[model samples]
Target: MTETRFYPKGEGMTLAELAALCEGELRDGADAGHRVDGLAALDDAGPRDIGFFDNNRYAAVLAETRAGGVLIARRSVHLVPPGVAALVVRDPGRAFALAGRALFPDALLPTGLELGGISDRAFVDPSAVLEEGVIVEPQAVIGPRAVIGRGTHVGAGAVIGPGCQIGRDCRIGWHASIQHALIGDRVILHPGVRLGQDGFGYSAGRDGILKMVQIGRVIIQDGVEIGANTTIDRGAIRDTVIGENTKIDNQVQIGHNVRVGRNCMIVAQVALAGSVTLGDGVAIGGQSAVNNHVTVGDGAQIAAISSVAGDVPAGARWGGVPAKPVRDWFREVTWVSEMAKQRRVPEVRHGRDDNDA
Candidate 1:
């Protein structure tokens, strides 16, 4: 259970109300009037909490949960024990999430210090423009000519560099450094997110490794959430654009001139080299690396730990080193493993070679 001191539950809702909110159906003499105020795992839920079961691995636990109500698929309704009200839904997981939001709305966003307005200890540049309702915390530095929109929260120690433009209702997390970026509304830059740093581009001149001037900016569209410690570089000639609604996981390194389309899911520890382009709905698994100048088309999925060296067509599923189609990759792996296994056979004494010295 979440501690009440840290997170308070919303007003309690009746079982009927929950069913309505989740588009679930309460069946078989369910006590619609029963009140629920908390949500918990099936194994830990008490009489006042709601629990959800989606996977068959938890079928045993579902039978014994003490929750006031349980969200389950129609096929599993028979597993519910007596005295427990079952809310039937197409997807138990989705229903549970909906119910959770209804009961714990505050848990939707990242928690931060509730500094109401500009802190007297913070430094706001004389030329910087901050709209009404913006909250700037202590030790934060807003550079000259920077514009932060209304209802945004700048967390402690955050540095909004000179000439940056941030839109409304955004949350700039603690210690985040934003330079040469234009971010849209409802964007969430989690703690330690580094945006618009110089890209890794250099030219070999007579003077030895000459660093190229990174003149472009990072453009983050609306509803984009960049996880903690993710660094996106500013482009050398064009803007590095992250499209709307892309959810990037923690520790991702997106290099210069990369264009990530809308609704893409990039897992943790993924590294995209400079000029890589990802179309809409693309999903790159954890620890994958996309080499520079490669493009992954829309709806493509690359498996975890894959090393992508070339372009992937739209709606493809690829995996393994130098990633290709998943089936081909698996077949090649199988063939190599079989050959290795064959080589492991011992050279019997009865089969001594004629050329043996």
Candidate 2:
């Protein structure tokens, strides 16, 4: 079983200290002397944990949590549990996040690279079978236990880690580093793509120092195409899975343990946090980011530059930062266009209008 550490339940900073750290105002609640440490989701909170609510949807769970205290915005102070201390903030989510970080910092990975790599210009295992059409370029390192299937092209300077499995007809681009990763058939990994790198894990000590530990692998299914400079981190615990036929565009950063479903189109510059789940056929536009552990439902469409901070239902089309439905976004865009119309230089219509001769 994975280690589950709890926060400092009763012996930690006061509500006042938390308020100061978040630069928030405390509204009506129990004494500021209340001690808080652990943080949990509103639905899964216990007496030792401090639950938070930024949106009204979680208001139902506010009274249900066994948490000793609650953190909420000033407007929702009335929803606080009876006799429970409240840490009021302008953004309860942000405050809770800060509190969680203070309580549980990530564990980092070790940086112990091998002393010396394989001597051969193209290092391949004897047990592994390569087809006649397969090409392993110079300085390409294929590990001792790795298997590169038929017609696969291992580009120059590519590093395939020990025990890796590359399927048939795959294109492993130049200078790509794949460690502890499984690549399926027909996959196209462009140059500079990094798969199965150690995740950014850090465990904070009493001395306020952090330690790193590498513990995971990456799994890419068949028919996937990863663009140039895209980075896919290995899992922190389980496998970071990219489903079949998924097209990930340039410069995307997919964090550890993420599960991206099949046929998903993740556009350029997208940042998917650790453990995020995307259902099948999801389309994420350029520069969008999904929060950690959030589930994006199937067939959902998110517009460019959107910041998704919450769950999106199946087939939903959303836009904007902290994304909402496209209908809501359309109204907002219309309003913005109306406001900015007068500020812009007036344009003369080239084509004929209704009054044209």
Candidate 3:
């Protein structure tokens, strides 16, 4: 029943092999030799496709699953069907992810071309230096004196500006424009990612707004994955730094000179203003905005649609407008909601008001 495959799939693996590959253990005397050839959801997975159940919302369907194998937590092992093999782990979601990664490695990380060779339609300047095993696709432009490291793939219509240095095994997506930037190894720049562009720097005076020439660079460290259509502006004086292993979602706007710490997670539509500093392991929810010059401490969690106008302490959970402590925000919201429920309390003394629902 599996159809419409976009990429090549790996060979089928046995239940024992999948368990070992995902660092999981089989439970309830499951047959270790059962073969699983595809991946799918619990309802769609067949006898040959592996499925996963980690969320409470899908608990009801676990008992009736027709799949031969299921990845689930130790606590949920009892819910597995009698004939199915249960692969128990501490984090079933992560284990399932590992299984998917092993089975379909290319799907997780798409290497545009399997064979390492530059396309004839691609344009590499005579002064550019491409290391061995680099793959350049059609319409890609590598400018003068650009140095692309080994095993990197430049997709169609991608533009690597002059003198830009990219490390090995990096993937530059289609139509991505990189200039005045230094990128590290294993970085993935998704389609339409615009880096090292002019920052929004202007001084207002009697003579009108004076644009400050953005001369600094953008430094993207190793293993950082930037999503599609996200724009990281070039620093005005120093450099816009995206720390190692940080994953930024789509449509993010990171202003000039913003320093994002390692392993930080910035969700989609988030805006980090110029000169803002995000400490390591911080996670900001979608559409959150951090004001300029604000510093978010390590491990801080900012809720979705929140605005941070001040410094956030380390490990604190903050939410709401102006972004205060979560508890305080909840309390304030609860109070306002409760207070609003008493409709026309002031008018009660003068006249009885009609109840409106």
lDDT of 3 by residue, 1-357 (tens): 466287556677889998888888999689898887778888777888888998878877877788889998888888897888999878888888888877777775544645459989989999999999999998899999999999888988999999999999999988999999999999999999999999999999999999999999999999999999999998999999999999999999999999999999999999999999999999999999999999999999999999999999999999999899999999999999998998566434335544432
Decide which is better by TM-score, 2 or 3. 3
- The TM-score ranking, best first, is 3, 1, 2
Better of 1 and 3 by lDDT: 1
Q: lDDT (CA) for every model shown? A: 0.94, 0.81, 0.91
Give the count of colliding residue pairs in each prediction.
Answer: 0, 8, 0
- Give per-residue CA lDDT, model 1, range 1-357, as digits (tens): 545666776678999999999898998799999999998888888889999988889889988888999999999999999999999998999999999888887776667788799999899999999999999999999999999999999999999999999999999989999999999999999999999999999999788998789999999999999999999999989999999999999999999999999999999999999999999999999999999999999999999999999999999999999899999999999999999988755555766854466
State which candidate, 1 or 2, has the greater TM-score: 1
Candidate 3 residue-wise lDDT at 190 = 92
lDDT of 1 at 278: 99
Number of the top TM-score candidate: 3
Q: How close is candidate 2 to the true structure, as a TM-score?
A: 0.60
Candidate 1 global TM-score: 0.92
Name the weakest run of 10 consecutive residues (lDDT summed) in model 3. 348-357
Clashing pairs in 3: none
TM per candidate comes to: 0.92, 0.60, 0.93
- Return whichever of 1 and 2 wins on lDDT: 1
Q: Cα deviation in Å at residue 4, candidate 3?
A: 5.5
